[model samples]
Target: MAGNWNNLQVPAGVRDLLPAEAAALRELEQELVAFFQSWGYQEVLTPTFEFVETFQAGSPAGDEGSLYKFIDREGRVLALRPEMTAPIARLVATSLRREALPLRLCYSARVFRYEEPQAGRLREFHQAGVELIGAGGVAADGEIIALAVETLLKAGLKDFRLGIGQVAVTKGVLQDLDLPREAVARIKVALAGKDLVGLERLVDEYSLTGLKRRQLELLATLHGGKEALEEARANFIQTGAAAALAGLEEVWQALTAYGLEKWLFIDLGILRDFDYYTGIVFEGYVPGLGVPVCGGGRYDGLVGQFGYPCPATGFALGLERVLMARGEGQGGGQGGYLVAGRDLAAVLRRARELRRPGVMVIIDGESQNRQEAAARAAARGLALVWVD
Candidate 1:
């Protein structure tokens, strides 16, 4: 029993995808790949693991604890990639250095993060997204968000909203507070979690007054559409956040051109966990899910950390989260051939003949006759090809 238990179970925070689930995932990936390609984004792949430094350059200070690390052959540190953006940045700086300006790259791969597993959070999960390298400004940001919305729609998610924000605005507002580093960090945590009570407590602790208190409170509580952005601009215009708000305004205008206003809203409080985000950032949400289905933002500084300075922006969708949001069931319950016969070669030939793209075919020589073959096919949710 112990041996059986050991063989049958996978580690926590990871799961085995049954055939149907795997098929569904493959179909989703293919559809997304096609959609990305249609947008001039070329697919690129990277190693599942890279040197720890690669990720550290893009992740935040305390994020190191989440990396799955180990020692390498030469006694150097290595870690499975927690995300693809940094690795792709490394690739662009080294291999694709000479690639023309405005490289559009996309990838669909598994990312590992040593975090507690929850309803939508997993230590090991799949992420698919794009990197629009060497392109900066509102057009790129708008395109990335547009692509994300369409991708979710492609995945069949009907009810969702993407909240967009400018980290520059958030950072500007924080810098204007002139608070201690520790205090600022705490305020950021509270804002990111939308904990207004904690934020109020912090304001009380710091003896914040007037505009400072109002700014912090607004950052924590402000959430809505265009009116919300206008409200933010009014509150932040006199502070350091004015420029960022202007930049966000341009991006918002561009997004409006895509007719995506209904799918997006402005949330100045949307501070992504990654420290690499230097400009616009956004996260997609589905009702009833505890996590964002997808997220990413501009990291113009990420590639430059690899010694090639460039502007870039992109987003990534969590495949499992998307599937969970869409409530997709295991697919492929029918339309497969189960060829069975008395002669082995005949069954093999029939199975081969039945093979085609998107079709599943199985050979069954053990069936005694057509009746047995039919029963077997029925049991397996497949069609029978009785050959004698």
Candidate 2:
């Protein structure tokens, strides 16, 4: 038999988070949980994986295909969770069936998606998010955006802007075009990426009129202050998409009432890839980073897909992305602690007592000296906390 050392490393686009990295991530998760809790949002944990059908039910991000799939003992098709919102919606419809209205829930979990991983993008990434269910209208939307802003602020991120958009606005434009559902979906994807060429090709394929074409082109640039919304209204007709735009206006008004307008920018072109989002959508972006640190929106119809009807809005902050935006990348004082001693009991007790909910390693070896132990720990990306 051939030796398998050649394939010993973890798969590409996947990595084992070292001690310090894991510790920093945990601290970030706890901070987010506490922030959500302070706003009366209770934390909840969903399973790491679920049935394939659960994820297939109307994903807005389009058919990216399943990231992780496996056949269980029962031979059922299962997949690693790509996102948390769908599971939370399922929870609300089933487990929390009789729960009170205006339910607020928060969760911090790793979501898996098979994609090219890069800085701030991972095959397995942790997301901290909150959902407010059973709440309708613009006030709920405003509150969700406000909470997102507050959460980032608590995370010590100051040089970031929240780009706000109303999916309704995009829907409204599509409604006036008389385009097929497939065309609209494709157009939305193109518009979401600000892919003007793709969108123009879509417009040509659909034979949209000059007016509609102009409206679609303008949508890409319809991002800024209040004036951007006004510009969109002037160019687009009052169709279904316009009705959605109206909802966006209402949300903007509510945000103003709460004095949170400063933290928000109106971007009518914004569209999250998730298929479930139905109304207002927003994302947080820093100056240099190419992607948003956080992104979310209203998904009022999601629960209905799971056998219930409840309005809801939520946001998910990518902890790793936030850390990167804040200039704290992978390697730092983040992970584990090295506790070494010949007397195992004493070392274990000391490590336990000093453990602060992050990663920790307790080394039990009689021959290794303190310096050797410290060096070993350092080499493994852990801090040296000798206890003997």
Residue 189, candidate 1: how far off, in angstroms? 1.9
Candidate with the greatest TM-score versus the true structure:
1
- The local distance difference test score of each candidate is 0.87, 0.82
Residue-wise C-alpha lDDT for candidate 2, range 23-139, written one tens digit per residue: 677788898999899999999999999997778753545574745889999999898998899899999999998988999999999999887777777888889999999998878
- Positional deviation of 28 in candidate 2, in angstroms? 0.5
Superposed model 2: Cα runs more than 4 Å off: 1-6, 61-64, 180-182, 201-207, 241-243, 331-388
Per candidate, the number of residue pairs that clash is: 0, 11
Q: Write the per-residue lDDT of candidate 1 for residues 20-49, one digit (tens) a residue.
A: 788778888888988999999999999999
